[model samples]
Target: MTVIVRDLRPGTPADIEGFIRVRHRALPYVFFSPASVLHGLSLPRPDAHARKLLAVADGEIIGTAQVGLAEDSREPGQGSLNVYVDPARTGRGAGTLLVRTAEEHLAAHGAVKLFAWVLDEPADRAFAERHGYRPSRSAHFLRLDLACAALPPLQDPPPGVELRTAADFADDPRPLFALDAEAGSDEPGDIATEFTDYAAWVDEYWNHPHLDRELTSVAVADGRPVAFSVAHTHDAGRYRTGMTGTARAHRGRGLAKLVKNDSLHRARAAGYTEAYTGNDADNGPMLAINKWFGYEICATEVRHVRELG
Candidate 1:
């Protein structure tokens, strides 16, 4: 069977649907939708030179790859590509073809180093090793049965703090952006990111198609957002935590747990049957908080990197 790679046609429904189908089958722990996929492609990232490629065999899409530079990283020449093939259609050379095409695209964009996430499974890890990629760090994908899990009971905010929803700041989300920038800088990851552009953040995150403003909880202190739990929901009755963080100054005050719990409770009440989130394997505090909420690690992926000479 001959497999060919081509750029995804954003205007074509079949292409977008195939991309989403392959992604969900390959990485079910995360959320994906036509809107989310299109939104990501529509966002401007000139420096990143982002491109989405699809591997087609016999007129059917068998694999997908998103290739781009790590534009937000403080470091230069960091390339990122994540390729996923339909689980039922492996061994057709689609994965290898997609990787080769993605690497070529990134290299043409002046990427000096390339990073990819491979599932912790033996075959996946071995494939990465064969491609000269070395494992770096791992992260876990957590799932909670919102329909039946014994979630922690909701609690009111402590003194001097008020619980709010992301919608409350809809008119002006600058404060939330400020909070996100401060808290997100501390997230554990190999690629260090600096979220300094407010307009870009607004387009990439604030107006994202999957973000659920009403279900996203925030903790306000001193009349500003100190902590927040960003929620994303799709039509499949699934809810995901895009990010949950607290300002450094408010870390010890239980604000992170407060906002997350609030968000989870509201998400469950809103008919989201499943909740999903991811955490760096080394992030003990967030892991502990998730455990307290009855989330179990369902899957893990190891980050792998390769240097291009």
Candidate 2:
């Protein structure tokens, strides 16, 4: 059987479904849907040259790859390509072909460093090494049994702080945008991103199909959002934490944990049975907070980097 790699046709429903299927099969801990896949392809950033590729064998998509440049990063020439093949379809050349296609695309876009995430398994790591990629950092995919696990009791915010839903910022989300920008800038990563485009953020994040405004908890201090936990829910009984962060000034106050707990409790009340989230292995504080919520590490992935001359 000949396996060929090509770009995904986003206009086709079959293509979108196939892409989501491969992703779900390869990384079951994360949430994905056709709408989310389409939204990602429709981002308005001029510099965001992203593409999704598929590996097809006899008209069936068995592998998928997401490739894009780190446009928002202050550092230039950094790109990323994450490839996932169906667990049932490994041992074919799909993974290798997808990687080659993604690397060529990133290099053509002027990427000097290419990064990819490989599951922390012997074969996955060996594949990266065979392709000239070296491990840099690791991350964990955590899952919580929302239906069975007891969530922390919701408490009133401290006297000076108030708990609010992301929906409260409907008329003017600029405050939440500012908070996200600041918190995301401080997030640990190989590429540093600066979120300056309000419109792009709205189209890509606020208006995403899976975003759950009612369950997304935000901590308000005085008048501004000091911390937030963004939630996204799928049609299936699954909820995912899009992001949970605290502003730099509020780091030591446990506001991040408070907001995230509020969000998770709301999600459970709303009938979400399973919850998933991921964190950098180096981020001990957030990891500990997730553990407090009874989340266990379901999978681990190592970031692999390759330099292109």
What digit string (tens of lDDT, one per residue) describes model 1 on residues 1-309?
899999999999999999988998999998788898899999988999999999999999999999999999999999999988898999999999999999998899899999999999999999899999999999999999999988888888999999999999999999999999998899899999989999999999999999999999999999999999999998889999999999998889999889999999888888999999999999999999999999999999999999999
As for candidate 1, its clashing pairs are none
Q: What are the lDDT figures for the candidates, one per model? A: 0.94, 0.92
My TM-score estimates for the predictions, one after another, are 0.99, 0.98
Output the TM-score of candidate 2. 0.98
Point out the worst 10-residue segment of candidate 2 by lDDT: 40-49
C-alpha lDDT (0 to 100) for residue 127 of candidate 1? 86
- Which parts of model 2 are misplaced by more than 4 Å? none
Q: Which stretches of candidate 1 lie over 4 Å from their true place?
A: none
TM-score, predicted candidate 1 vs. hidden true structure: 0.99
